[model samples]
Target: MSPEPLQTGRRRRFQEWPNYRWAVLGLTMAGIASTSFPITVLSASLPVIADDLQTSESAVSWVQTAPLIAMAVGTPIAGKFGDLYGHRRLYLWGYALATGFTVLTGLSWNVGALVAMRTLGSFIGAATLPASMAIIMTVFARRERALALGYWSAVTALSPAIGVAFGGFMVDAFGWRTIFFIQAVPSLIALLAAIPLLPDTARKPEVRFDVAGAVSLGLAVTGLLMAINRGPEWGWGHPLVVAGLAVSPVALVVFAAVERQTADPLFPLEFLARRGFVIPNLVTFLGHMAYMGTLVVAPFMLERSFGITEVSRISAALIARPVGFSVGAWYAGRVESRLGGRAIMIVGALTMSVALAATGASILAGWLAGVIALLFVAGVGQGAIRTPAVAGVANSVDDADLGVATGSLQMIGHIGAATGITIMITVLGPSESSERFFAIFLLAAAIASASAFSARWSPGLGTARSAGAGRRSRW
Candidate 1:
């Protein structure tokens, strides 16, 4: 017999292996993290970047903020496109384009150039979220989705913490440009692996793409996110912010009208009515407001309230929450079968809320240990809810619309994060008073508590029920 037949047989068996999905998960995550980790790494070294480029820290912040805003606006559209085309194609294409932009980001000569490159990279890279989620969901069995999503959530949660943990050191040792340059290598490797390893998803070529709906919805998200993002910076009364606020509702109304009239809508209007779908998104929105709000404030609190000046100590403290989040998400993914989604989410939210409230007290009392511990607990709480919530949303939607559903969820979460960051900063203002820190954290706690309360409305489907739903929804 020829060796060619033997080689073909081995390749077929490898593809048929059940654990191949894990390979898919690992590679795609590497691609996603490669593009994303740089932004967070840059966050820690904004002062360095600003100084290098002859600009202010505030001006350099656009390197982070603009990319976030771009991702918020672009993700859903990219997801819808992925569904119309194929997720595997989009994942590879998006990452490949993003890798090129990552290199450009490293080579940027000025702040404006860096911001533009990063924003464009993130905007195109946004496709990876829905595409990766859809791919993983397709590969994993229904009962296994929670665990898969849990690991996915853990990576997403931990990457930023890891970036912040090492970002400052890397910037000081190697300079900021080298970071982006190095990031591109992993992305390129992932793109290569994906060419053969990732499974091709079924595409819906017959369905007419919803151009009008996509445009109007994109406009609406852009307007609303821009308003929230810029309102604090430019002042709420700034004409551009006001215009953004004004445009959002009108664009939303137009989007609703377009979605209704379109033959193939970008998003299914009926999913809005699903308790499983809506509640997780609502909880995510509120939870992130607290989670990210605390993240933005902790460094400042350490300096102002705790009087801690060491960057290493501050970085160590800042890493606690996301590290906690990574652990909680990992644990939740494993036990979702026994504890159920609703219970886990409620517990997570309540835990976060209580921890955040305690954090405020810790800061006021200047107990650095307590503050670090509380932040870690807050992170765990947020992480615990994320995997179950994402898995729940995936189970509720049809297999074909998984990308759109997950994309929309991601977009909402990003919007919530931006809003939370903005609100915390606004409330904290320039005052170094511990009382101001306390007030802002309490506000965050209240918001988190509201999220906990909202979780009760979510579907209580455990792994079994979710599995049943997944079977019924499969394309």
Candidate 2:
């Protein structure tokens, strides 16, 4: 379907600014934390979970793979659902489903049960990632959207950093299942918040659910995730891997066509094709690719090269990440009110490059402090780029398709981070040595800087100076 126009003017009925902003933003963070918590939680819990299930580490590793596979497939579909339905309602349901599965996950008796339950659970839970953004865009004005996106981005990104530092202790103290239990906090909190806090505003639904598009895209993403996830273990050239790799590309092409032709496609082709919407997604995808390198490999390097068992606590250095992200977001958010998304994105991209290179230098030197400081810088850049990036898309497009746009944004994240991590691991040699990782950071840094250049030519998404400000919004 065509892009829906955003609701203009002041908030109607009970959906006031400042009030709805905090609550919705809080819930967005909570939803993202709960949905994606297990990815890192399971990593921490692997020792206990493997022992309890009498499984090999290699066999149980699918816990991470399965969820990504599900989420990769589910994200866009869920995004479309949010657009078709109400994002607020869908957010609540996503939380509710996540809460139920999390509880069931803690009760599983064996690895098989655990894997199966989690597979189903991820499909339901991870939908919140995209849905939350859709709801936020639906509620906020164009000028306010960037800062809102900025704050939301900071909180969501901070979750894994928090998970890394704390997940280990939580597992050691409360057992691995506590990870699942802890996830319930967000679900319960968001569910409660939605009752009184979620704005009851609704869009005049326009996009029709494309069943064929759903199946094709779902199959393609699931197949691609499986191929990439298993490629590390199974060998990318394995017959099944070859088949998955071959199928996904074809399906992806078909999925693109479906969007282009369908009268009311599940995903709008214009947003994906447009510069404002597409450029930031591309740069952010690269940024996430760089982040994937840090997120997955940093601790491994520390553990192997430095022999640090208390790496979890050391990982707390990443707290600096949220610090940078928040600062970057606030600054860029303020600028997005007046300047434009393109300019802010360029700064964020530049920050990303510097941070990634510094990260490499620190890795080579084996200094944890340097690494942490670099991460903080990278995060700030990430924060600056994302707020305007998303606001660019949200402001450019009509509101009816806001859910689709937001979901597409997040889906790019999942697809890029998922594939990028796999690719980085493949290239980094798995040795955890500074030399082995040096290339990783260098390459990531290069990508960041290059993406910055690309952002300049990207299409404009348009921007609001600020809802409260008395100026024109830029794109």
Candidate 3:
């Protein structure tokens, strides 16, 4: 063979630049963590916010609800749009909007304005979620995909912890609004960093935007989430709850019909129908349900069953979960290439199942140490499952569909978390008994076990295929 051309060698070396991918990942992680600050801070500062605005707690709660609904609706739309347009452009726009909105949120004069501004900001910021993932998938080859996802998972799992700690300090020092100001700083930094570091994906100009499908899907998701969130407060049988439940299904049906008629559907039914795509997402939903349900129920169980009333102690015990999550996520990424995504997910799910079961046993036996340890194990399992599951879903889809596919998976997972919390709360009921706590944990365990079984059907179950080759596999 003739000697390799010098220009070709230089091009190959440039393509293999190690710092570029890491820089992209770092910027995206900062953006993700910064955006999440509002959620945790808002939850912590609710009492202060309500008092400052001279509003009832219920009314002030809308600040959180508005963003939650906006995120759920906006995520898929952003993902699909990014797929059609360019993800880099959408990402930059998202950060700019987020930074501006955070500043506006800090300056809000009333509850209603705060809610509206936060909702708009979150809706725009939601674009960054899918766009960042799409960029990571495009830049990193298959061998490194799981590791990149692992770091992504770790940052996500760790962000709430960081937010809570810093938010509490800011709320105490400068008041609730200061947290928003703090949030804006990082977002501005991420936006500036992304401008120069992020790579642009080729735009599919031929793909038509499905306005009807987007609207229908957004309405459907909003209705369903609203019903779930308000069911306990309004009573599941309340007229509004019943109406919301009814509307969601009707909207979903309309969305399906609209998608069928669209030239470039927001959600491709054929893609969703595939076993590779569907099964991993199913596992994700089940796993998050179990994880979130247990997390919400644990503090109550600790206070009532173990009588651990100290806020610091409770916080310390809860903190272990995220710690475990960070460790497990990092480790999963390191080993995924060797063990494969399916195996890692299966193991992760089973670990969570065991942790849930142990939690139940610990509560029943009145073992505080056991409860804390089990909580950590559950967190680890949750983290492990997430990294592989996300990577698996990304690997299963074509390059064009990466954004929407990942967005849909995250949407399903959030729905699962909401559903899980609702169901667990119902199980706890108007009681403070160990028996009820045990029941909740056992139910979570069952859900976790089911998630493990579902992992069996993930694409490339035992194979060690590279990213490029994985994309060519049968649906």
Give per-candidate clash totals: 0, 11, 0
Candidate that scores best on lDDT = 1
Estimate TM-scores for all models.
0.94, 0.88, 0.92
**Candidate 2 residue-wise lDDT, 298-415, digit = tens:** 6676677667777455455546766687778777767677777778888888988988888888878878778878888888897888787778767656676667776777777777
lDDT (Cα) of model 1: 0.85
Q: Where is model 1 more than 4 Å wrong at Cα?
A: 1-13, 468-475
How does model 2 score by TM-score? 0.88
Q: Give me the displacement of residue 136 in model 2, in angstroms.
A: 1.6
Better of 1 and 3 by TM-score: 1
Write one digit per residue (lDDT tens) for candidate 3, span 207-257: 789999998999899889889877986799998788889999999999999
lDDT computed for candidate 3: 0.83
Using lDDT as the measure, what is the rank order of every candidate, best first? 1, 3, 2
RMSD of 2: 5.0
User: Across residues 1-475, which tens digit of lDDT does each residue of candidate 1 receive?
Assistant: 2112233354456679877889888877777777666555677778888999999988898888888888988898899988889997788788888889999999999999999998998899899899999999999887888888888888887887777766667777889898887788888887877776777788999998888898888788888888888888889999989998999999999999888778799998878767878888999999999999889888899999878888777887888887899899999999998888889999999999999999999888888899999999999999998988888888888789888988999999998998899899988889999999999999999999999999987766436555545223321
True-vs-predicted CA distance for residue 427, candidate 2, Å: 1.7
Candidate 3: regions farther than 4 A off: 1-17, 309-312, 461-463, 466-475
Q: What would the TM-score be for candidate 1 when compared with the true structure?
A: 0.94
Lowest lDDT 10-residue stretch of candidate 3: 1-10
Output the lDDT of residue 64, model 3: 78
Deviation in Å, model 1, residue 20 alpha carbon: 1.2
